[model samples]
Target chain A: MVLTWAVIGKMTQRDPLPDGTMRHSRRRVLRVGALLALGGTVPSLTGCEPFNREPPPPDPLAPMVDEALALAAAYRDAATTHPTLASRLTPITEAHAAHAAELARITKVALPSATPTASTPADSDATLTGLRELERAAGESATQACLAAPAERAALLASIAAARASHLEALQ
Target chain B: MNTRTPGARSAHAAALTAEYAAIWAYGPIGVRLTGPAQEAARDAEATHRRRRDTLVLRLTDAGDSLPADQAGYALPFPVTDEPSALRLAVEVEERTAGFWQAAVAATSGAERERALAALVDCAVRATRWRATAGITPLTTPFPGRTA
Candidate 1:
């Protein structure tokens, strides 16, 4: 009923993160080992192949890191598309950048060199609404990640989640 | 496998203490405002009271000891005007959310959920207060992070 590691798998399927970032976060060795053992990665009859040569499972926080970067990009694009709203939207974009940087640091994942460019809707109100929805979903995902995280990591996830949730009001 | 309401006991106890402080501070905040703002203060106080009672019961059920609520908490700044009261309300919620955030780290399962709900609730309220006071940047980058 409570965090059976299924949550991490769920997040993995929900967000398509770059495979490059998956190599980081050594803390995941145990989880990866558990996954390999459970998956029966080897076909050898003796099952004595102690090594799980298959690539490591993606770090559970990688998607969040990716999501943070995406949100930042979306906000940045929105700001660029609608210069009149830049004053209000710039701070949120900056916040997401900070969140992404912190998450990347914690996971030992390097951020993408170039921020992806996303097309913004023609209507500024529509763009703002779209941003709000993204923030809302991001907040919900971060909340789940916080619950699934180990104690040491939960605090940052909690803050990220809360910050995202508060952004709804900022958008309004 | 043991799963007896897992979390650090001290964290939730501290959250309980925060609720007590929130409830206490709302008195000065409520007195400074009239109309809907006053009502908002009343609702906020009642919310804190309910959470305090619920947490007390939960800790008791979990066989975890609780810290007692004090008679009063010193106000960070005097609530002299409507603006100041609104500001205090925001501060109270933010500070309360910090404790809940720590609880979220220290806890798991239902306790973590409760702490998270409290944190979100406080963050939202803090935002509302900021918006109400005409402050810029309604949301903080990290709601409960002190720095």
Candidate 2:
């Protein structure tokens, strides 16, 4: 166990980017450290006490759910404004809604009731382009979240990220 | 009930196996496609190969045992035509992404990054295959998740 932890420690050190800066963000470094500390085999520290001491700062899923909802709303608004694109946009919007619901269920959090601010693109092509940009940003966020997440949540985050990437392609 | 936990090595091994299968599967997928589609299949195959090579190096450096690729694999279904081939391509990418998702759960740090990137790659490829196949929606709410 000790050897395993040491191996993980060595592996977590960020590689230099092309510009010679470390790849990890400060938040990622902290998350990695917390994950490593949890991975350690010290029996006394493994009890429920440490984990139960304070609730985690916030569930990352909250923001993820919000993003999904917002994306869905944007698609819906786009569809309403450009009725011609409704048939094409509706399915993607519905998929986003489903994603938000599933994420909320998994996190055991109540869904947010706030209405999403919709995109007011001027024309059909602009709507599609705006959607493509939205999907790209969401995909990037999900990718970063996947990298920062622990083992249990990583799969969900990765899947969401991948879905968003595909959404971008489909939007094109 | 068994309480055993599988580690990062096991997950990485699973991903390697999926990559091996993906590389083999693309041979049939490419032959059935034409023009740009065929070129795309070839590019996808190369991507899997590159990932496989990287995984081999990472596992080797970590002193983890590597799984040997099979001489051949059984296709999920017969790929005798273009439609079947496109479907197989989609299946291949989705299946490979599943393994990478598991790897994301089992590994950490650089290994996790690799798994996440691979997962995204497979997802995007799967979407393209779906589009080529004329599958409706063309994207999933969750790429790797079955439920």
Candidate 3:
């Protein structure tokens, strides 16, 4: 003979009357099904209630990754027009790429795959001004991240922020 | 090891969402960007694509449901000029950084490490944007910025 245990609740209590016999019910089976359903529900729920759900909020890493990617773009752009800075800029761009990869690893998120158009305004003066302005904004973000997160995160942010500082210097 | 837990998986998914938004923001960003900036934009986009693939595998391996990327995403504003583009770039980084910060709180151990790394990465990128924009006081003091 063969014995198989189906997915059912087992309640072998001492026979209330005399000889020992067990009684089973639908309640246990229902409970297990509910757990499975809830497990599936949470992920979907996150999408529905991105703001309300009391789970840990979204990671701050997204901005950092974006910034890193942006920095790479900026540096790469500078390298083309200002070949003098190409060598100096390339490493910085690479650093940003590395930072983006590291962050993606942590968040388990996909990075974008689209290329930017690099549309500079028609005016050369405007182009220079815009570049300067952009650099400042990038630096500010890194500084804010360094200040806002915990020690480990703060330290990491600070280092990246420092790198940005160097970029700013190079731009000058 | 603990990647299967609700907390851990949520963190991972959040990271992916940020990546999605960053990818979207690049379109407008690249338009105003020029030269090496364009190449960097392309490379960044490729990086996101690769990372996105990695994320899908990790989530699936950990028994998590992966979120699908939208065919089109709405931009916060029109990308008419370089200034607007830079502003949008800042906005994207800040928002995405907040998401990763949330993941850090939601997870633990290796998951936590990844979340923290993501958070750090965002913060760093944000700083770079600020610097490019010539904004002072670049970067957030911490990750998971609320405001």
Candidate No. with top lDDT: 1
Ranking by DockQ: 1, 2, 3
Misplaced by over 4 Å in model 2 are A1-56, B1-6
Give fnat of each prediction, in order.
0.80, 0.88, 0.00
Q: Please write out the lDDT profile of model 2 over residues A1-172, one tens digit for every residue.
A: 6654553454456657789886655565566456557766433333322223554455767888899999999999998999988877888898889888978887888888986889567878888998998999998888888888877787888888888888888877
Tens digits of per-residue lDDT for model 3, A97-171: 766776667667688896443544545455456666776787678666655655445445544554454455544
DockQ of each: 0.76, 0.55, 0.03
lDDT of 1 by residue, A49-150 (tens): 223345555688998888999999999999999999998889899899999999999998999898877779999999999999999999999999998899
Q: For residues B24-128, what per-residue lDDT tens digits would candidate 3 score against the true structure? A: 778878889887656756666676666667778899987788887887688888988777776777677667767766665555455555555555555556665
Task: List ranges where model 1 is wrong by over 4 Å.
Answer: A1-52, B1-7
Ten residues in a row with the worst lDDT in model 1 chain A? A42-51
Docking class of 2: medium
DockQ of 3: 0.03
Q: Which pairs, if any, clash in model 1?
A: none
Docking quality band of candidate 3, CAPRI definitions: incorrect
lDDT of each: 0.83, 0.82, 0.61
Ranking by lDDT: 1, 2, 3
Q: Pick the candidate with the highest DockQ.
A: 1
Report candidate 3's fraction of native contacts.
0.00
lDDT of 1 by residue, B28-130 (tens): 9999989988988898899999999988887787788788889999999988999999999999999999998988888887778888889988998899888
